[model samples]
Target: MMYPPPESQSLKTLLPETPILLMGSGPVPVPQEVATASSIVISHLGETMKKIVARVQLMAQYVFQTKTTKIFGISGPSSAGMEMAIGSLLWPGRKVLVLNLGTFSARFAEMARGVGAEVKEILPQGLAPIYIEQVREAFEKDSFDVLTIVQGETSCGVKNIHLKEIVELAKSHGVLTIVDAVCTLSTMPLPMDEWGIDIVFVGGQKGLSAVPGISLIAISENTFQFISNRTQAMPHWCLDPRRAFKFWGLGEYHYTAPVTGILALHEGLRLICEEGLEARFERHLKCSSALQNSLEAMGFSLFTPAEFRLNSVVAINNLSNVNTKELISLLIKECHVEISGAFGLDIIRVGQMGEQSRFENIERVIRALAFGYGKFGHKLDLESGLKVLNISRDSGKK
Candidate 1:
């Protein structure tokens, strides 16, 4: 006369639990202040009437190290940022050479093609980082008007390290550089001006730790000139950067932006400056290193190579032993932690930026993983994990 213990008794039988950690896409959890900040007028003229737009632009200038040209809040998600930036600058019949390391880079190439540009994608030879030599060969053979790179290719755990060199090379050839820094900006130091990056886009969800509605696009003066000279009509209405500048600048916006998102992003930028960029980046490094070490110690292979691993998120190979869906469910229900599993890539991405970058929390996450797997009849060493986790946390700090 006994009853079943519970559906989740064996990890295999449990319903998927909500990830407690919530680190999957950008537009991550925003700080309370972002919501609390009173939104100003949404009218194009209203932008100049109040200090909100000015403050946001100033903060961006401080954080990104770029002189104020213009800033605008587009309505769509982060992808919209790329679209707006690319749509504004790419002209029909111009040749564009893309550095496609992952999904986002492929998206960039598609967007370029949509604008009627002749596109060529440079696919990496293997699972390694995109070698500088490969890029050099591509540049030597092709004369492209635009070059695109994803700074931290979240789809694959490859961070494009030769971005500076690529940007310089593009400049030498009179090719405009477009960068998707959606996952890299705040987690890593991005001195856009120094790097010679022409057009850069970042999402609020990733490094910014703000809500998803706000996407930032910063353009260099040269890129601005390129956009001004484009002959074809831009496909999207709200995505027109020149119209945005008119609104965010002295003129009224030809269209409206997401007013609330702009408010939140302003405060988010303030928080980042208050925290100090170097300290924030160091914290991110420490957390990522710890997570990588813990996973490796527990017999998991990292999808990202040692040299090109991104700071904000680490991708762990699923391997043969574990069912990723079951593992995520157990960790969520039993541990109240959230980690993201990549599609197409057999890996789970753990975030370590903003509020989630706590040492104890990272250690707790490892423990939960250990316990979660143990429940599934997998033998795990909880005792030895303690030693390995500590070593990882310690080494990552240095």
Candidate 2:
């Protein structure tokens, strides 16, 4: 018996010769340092790995704006991080109040239901963000064991501006809060401890600009106590934080940890700390405002209004004359730039996440969008849009 020989291919033709620019909803380009970190893989149980893991936790706390040491990285995506929160906290007959705002909120409800929890969702139809009054009404109407919400809805670029207030109301009703900050953390201000958030999770691919596959999760002391006293065992062992903490917290073996992803996440969090949260927020805001204004000037409509729009990801409505799918093709195939089409929505999303929010990339994306629109036989105010972008860049220097 012998192993079969492998087929051979030219390395030159293995990938696209021209680098495709990632201006999409997530998995945006990582910085040089973060990319370099991902290549350094050491023994998962070694002392060097322990220090990296500790630094990651400390940096994650800084990014999450929390003092809780319960923060740790998950070997899966944000959904896995969220699954840990949902499965560990809820069991059969438990009730959850879902402030259904967008795609991810709907997913939270589905995941809660899967855990045998009673799910009640309050969805504000259309592109509007969930109002505080709606949340207040839900709390007053019935008692719930937990409340889950998204700080920023990635699907349509809508954000809950009243997140802190909503969390306070939930706490008043004795309901624990779990926030999905996958697209918001490090890109904007989400003071977890300050707002009394019980459980918070983030995806490294978006705001943190790390490659996909690793996500961060944190829990408050109160939430930890609740999980510790759960009636049933957690639904999953790999997704459970109690098992994960043995490796991330106590420096022990849990699984063959994704060392590369952890190192990349560590670098991402370090970059966020080095830039400082305030400056990072300002950068995202500056770039997003410019991108939004430029799009509007080019006669493109946005999915959500500026007041409650998510800055990290901006959704551009597919106008009556242009199909978003076709436009996305033009952006990718011809323009060498890429964006995302909303699932079952007449909108497309362009990312304003970490490296995507860089000034030069912002300009490049705007120019590529203009080119795509022109190719589709739709004349846009390209000069006007560029003028607005230039003005924003100049004003930002002050």
Candidate 3:
């Protein structure tokens, strides 16, 4: 008989008086299944922990759609996974080519440079998409061993749709590919094996809707062999993928694993499987589209262009008349909604990911935003935004 998950109070139950709407980049509301898993008590070095580790490994395989690649669950957030990928693949004398689309890609390049690797960046101007011709030109001018990129840059709400082409280009030139899919793992279409990505990592909290602290890294066989054959020792133990796989995969017990985090991720992936990958992707897209249409109707312009915009996160420009900080404070204080702050320019980021990606949630955010704008003496066209939402709903029905 299969045992059921433990019962626990949810975030809503704990905070009954104040209900918060989380539309930030990560740590979204968790589903009941994930919360239940997190509430369970399991030993760090026991049969239950072993089963949990195996379940997570299997879930990673399913989520990434890979059969032969090695998967490891690091006991940290997605940044740890990024470090592991870089440390495993890049060393001294190695050259890395990074496509700097946003803050995350810039971080990847910084990490590469910190590791004594020669780094060249293809920084796109503003929020524009990096064209293939630019990448071709860069590749022709410089010879690099690894190409690092982010599939979806959460900071600027940009998705590189031409990731497969970029990876194929790198592979053709004998260059390894490293992808950071922290924001687009389950919400977008990413076939690691089919697209020929060498190393990729994702966060458990962002798209998977699990608690933060688990980073799943999937390594291709060729990349695994390359890391295994490296003569130089990795600077840190956590940055070594072989050590992570040995401890997490083989149950050798490197350090204390995050049992609750692993179990929560397992349940989160199970829920994703139940929802069906294509269905989840469609839900995210529809919700994002509705949010964008509503925001545009309310006289707010999106930061990223339509072609390069991400379905998981939407960034909007701040009104010239209203103070951004004051607007954000009013939204949280009065409307009980929480969103991310501004980045380079005055832009607000809203995430529609995992359990938060629903029609009711999207509508709630729009209404709160409209109400907040009203408090600042600026009247927004809420009716027009609602009409757009209704139209989107009707179109979906048809």
Evaluated with TM-score, which candidate comes out highest?
Answer: 2
**TM-scores for candidates 1 onward, in order:** 0.88, 0.96, 0.93
Model 2 lDDT on a 0 to 1 scale: 0.89
The candidate maximizing lDDT is 2
> Which tens-of-lDDT digit does each residue in 303-346 have in candidate 3?
88899898888989877677777887788778787777766668
lDDT minimum window of 10 residues, candidate 3: 12-21
lDDT of 2 at 238: 97
Clashes of each: 6, 0, 0
lDDT of 3: 0.85
Clash list (residue pairs), candidate 3:
none
Report lDDT (Cα) of residue 9, candidate 3: 69
Name model 3 segments beyond 4 Å from true: 1-17
**lDDT, residue 274, candidate 3:** 85
Q: Residue 290 in model 3: shift from native, Å?
A: 1.0
**All-Cα superposition RMSD per candidate:** 7.1, 1.6, 5.9
After superposition, candidate 1 runs with Cα above 4 Å error: 1-19, 25-27, 38-49, 388-398
User: How do all the candidates rank in terms of lDDT, highest first?
Assistant: 2, 3, 1
lDDT of 3 at 105: 89
Q: What TM-score does candidate 2 reach?
A: 0.96
